[model samples]
Target chain A: ARPRVGYFYSGKKPGQDISETMNNMKVGDFQSIPVVVREDVSVYDAISQMFLDDVGTLFVVDKKSFLTGVLSRKDLLRTSLGNQDLSTIPVHIIMTRMPNVTFCFKNEPLIQAAHRLINQQIDALPVVIEQPEGLKVIGRLTKTNITRAFLSLSESHEL
Target chain B: ARPRVGYFYSGKKPGQDISETMNNMKVGDFQSIPVVVREDVSVYDAISQMFLDDVGTLFVVDKKSFLTGVLSRKDLLRTSLGNQDLSTIPVHIIMTRMPNVTFCFKNEPLIQAAHRLINQQIDALPVVIEQPEGLKVIGRLTKTNITRAFLSLSESHEL
Candidate 1:
């Protein structure tokens, strides 16, 4: 069966345009440098990068910092507890590879990005822009960013 | 400032006993083996254990498996990204020590545990039982557990 889409906001009025509502906000406004790790980095090093960056997800990049893949805490955890050595395992081995990643451009609506996060049940999104070579991951949008936006809206609406 | 509590359910009716709504549930019913790590274990090994467990939060246990503290991905990440060696750092050095942890008993109403998680913006709680020696980490309650219950309730309510 096709996975559910926009299931997170099923309570929205049937005629409403979620994308339209989200259009008022722009992805560029919320983007921040993503927690990143190299493809060759050990799973051990990747986990360290996550903790130091205070992020649950890390965007894997190439030597040129091109978007390569994504790895999350669960990925590192799975690779760590096994009988194998964590230092021997590279993060790229477990990352959700590129092209398969759901990403948003700098000007995309924040809500659209959030929808991808919710629908996929993933934590964050890599905000990228097309460069001559490929997609260079510029920043990220996370569920937390959406929540902050929601809170900001609610607070202002109450006023 | 004292952190906010019950803000997650501030919409709750003024006269309502939130616990009353949670009577049908028990922490034991929602508890699972929290991803765990030993206090003395290297931060590197701890990250490995997390991936193996498929859990976001890791309950720290002592030699006797008694609850000592909690380690989150953030904790490990904070310790990892710097020049400090993750392999040499023990988990306890970064764990949120006991008495500072937000937790609940197996018999506490599930709503109460859920409330603590939401109010504090924490990921999981170690379910414990008090013993003469100390608190024995029996199981865990996580946001995913609460989300599961919420989905179940919504489905039933619709029916």
Candidate 2:
């Protein structure tokens, strides 16, 4: 006689479809803190920062702290094989400069970013905020984040 | 009186559960070809092989072709910083030796493998088959593969 009010509470989002749930996943929700280095930093120092921070990619910023390039471990490894003095060579010399850098926006769907990572054959993407001067890297979205999102799918459904 | 069989064919699995679908994804279905190197190969050669193959991780095998260790881009980058002769150092010295390496099996569920990738904080895992002699490296599972699987979920449901 109470209109079956209590029976509807199943502790789950009623009729929540998987596709709808996935589409709601945003890059800002899963992105990690981005690591950035000044373009003038040495390759040796950049490598050191990579190890110290334990990240796979580093965004290169200009004197105004605007994104100018990106650096990956693969880039650093390739340069190491050159037998050049790493300490003397600036990261800008080896970095993948703008106009070639692949990036994403935080408010976008995570799936879109995932496609970019796969198609571009890259490890990470700088999540950027468009600015009057240039792109400002706000976060890092990578395969690791995608993997975590994949795991979360199962985890949420398990409940 | 065919019980409306034709109408029921909506091209979707009947009453399919999200968790059930996820658990059905196997590691073998998403694994990539493993790039391996001999334990005796010089660090320089290993690095070269990694670049040629464009893989982030390399499995190290013994003379018997049994899994012995694993090498990551991080490992090689650290070694490069030593300023030592990379060609003179065998990968065995820098590799993350067996018993310390985290691996997976092809038959394992993708969700389980994804958990390992997140918990271990490793880029990739050597998918292996256990033999009487030792583990045989059969494939490689990485974050890239996991990311692909994530994309597939949204794709399959889009219809």
Candidate 3:
């Protein structure tokens, strides 16, 4: 299913304003270049991508690099545990499809992205940009990125 | 480095209250039983334990079952990428040690525990209780657990 652009949240408390500090901070500032994959790739190749990229998650894209699905270590580990041949199994079979995947825009506030990551219980959020074709994968906001932000804030504040 | 219990956080933009909905929630209500492991276990055994347990993380414990360290796919994957022997390596060498690990008491607000997970870039938070010996891990709050909670809320709200 193609994921709708609607944001999935009710906020920590409904009345809460997006923190001024977070709203000022955008995803582009902290996001890392995403390790993209094609839906046709075998699961074995996806695992290799993870190893080579040193990332726990991968964003599956079409030939256009349009967002299609997402894959994580748990997804690979769970599927690989059985007797099935990873080489024969295509990524689309196990990948979490669009609309089901959580994503953020590059200009969006960091708090919104963090909310999705924590509330949705996903490891990373694919930073996507809208195009005539569809939502195309760009960068990614991961927990590690957020942790680095927190550490930077801590270090700067202590000064 | 040992992390203190101090809540190092600012308000959600100002006039916000800890989501009245989330502040009322407890980890005991949402946590899953943790897959436990021993410190002396070989890396290979730990990986096998992960397969058998069907979990991305394993709680490394001692004979007393008191919590000692935590292991996840990233840890194993990173270590195994090396040419060194996995069968000979002990789990204790790679696990995130206590006092350094972020944990949550069953009675703590789920929101607070979630903050630690996102801020620390960790995949799971051990739901623990304090004993004379140390903190004993009783259950675990994972991103999947949080996703379940969000889904439940979404489904109910829709109905």
Candidate 4:
């Protein structure tokens, strides 16, 4: 098929304008599978889960499987510096608890989520669904995801 | 100044094409200050430095100040899980050493460096200056920087 290029309006254009294309990019299109752990799980186990999943951030959930908190590698590392026993300490004691966790919705524009990442200085955000009980994590969005989106933008328009 | 838009090329346009603008974003324009630790520094001290600097990755250098290795919080956290004393273990023993390290030059297109970060599955890369002896650590390129660039693109064109 010939590359989609429009004269002025869409008379059957192949590609959207750059701004239009970028603005249309949504978090759901690029989010990754979220790895979650229950609030009572040991910090030691949480760290293990992090490595196994190879994610920088992990979402913490309650017994109802609703969002409760968030854990980062930095958080775990800081706790490790203490002389406390990691296995005996539950992640809830160390996690950045709910009402403090930054989040995004799957339908949110990628640019808005990217701004949250930069301004908040965070590694990842749980892409969540609003539940009667609490937020249910449906996906993970990170700088990595934004970076991928940025690359895709350039790739799509490349000759 | 009115927003520059051209019908084709040259003439009296103000804004260049999206592809041209994206391609022109160089690593040097977006890289962050690199934080380095001597290879011989204790893992304990390195972790402290990471918290102090608030950076995800730390570059390792030799006495001569050339890049030798790189450390991520994951590396340090893994070491912490060990029974051994962190202060006794040197960062050199745990760092991802040279030759295996992925890097980018200052003049490299941001897209190229973003690819290296994703392909290598790393949080950051040392923006380096090559020398006869080894690579000189100059700046740090990370997903965060890429995310910022992505946001900037949207902000620049927003009405």
DockQ-sorted candidate list, best first: 4, 2, 3, 1
Q: Per-residue lDDT for A50 in model 3? A: 96
Candidate 4 — which residues are off by over 4 angstroms?
A: A1-16, B1-15
The residue pairs found clashing in candidate 3 are A3-A99
Candidate 4: give the clashing pairs: A4-A14, B4-B15
**Fraction of native A-B contacts kept, per candidate:** 0.03, 0.42, 0.11, 0.38
What's the TM-score of candidate 4 when only chain A is evaluated?
Answer: 0.89
Evaluate all candidate structures by whole-model CA lDDT and list the values in order.
0.68, 0.90, 0.74, 0.88
Better of 3 and 4 by lDDT: 4
**Candidate 2 clashes between residue pairs 3 or more apart in a chain or in different chains:** none
DockQ pick, better of 1 and 2: 2
For model 4, what is the error of residue A20's alpha carbon versus the real structure, in angstroms, after optimal superposition?
A: 1.4
What's the count of clashing pairs in each model shown? 11, 0, 1, 2
lDDT tens digits, residue span A1-159, model 1: 342233332221122222223356788886777877789998878876776777778998899988989997666655554546677888888899988888888888665676567567677789988898878888888655654554333233321
Per-residue alpha-carbon lDDT of model 1 for B51-130, expressed as tens digits?
Answer: 66656788988899888999886676555544466788888888999889888998886766776775777878898888
Q: TM-score for candidate 2, please give it.
A: 0.91
Chain B vs. true chain B: TM-score for each candidate? Answer: 0.82, 0.90, 0.85, 0.90
TM-score of each: 0.55, 0.91, 0.60, 0.91
| Candidate 4 or 2, higher lDDT | 2
Cα lDDT tens digits, model 4, A1-159, are: 343343332222133356667789999999999999999999899999998998889999998899999999999999999868889999999999989999999999998888888888999999999988799999999899999999998888765
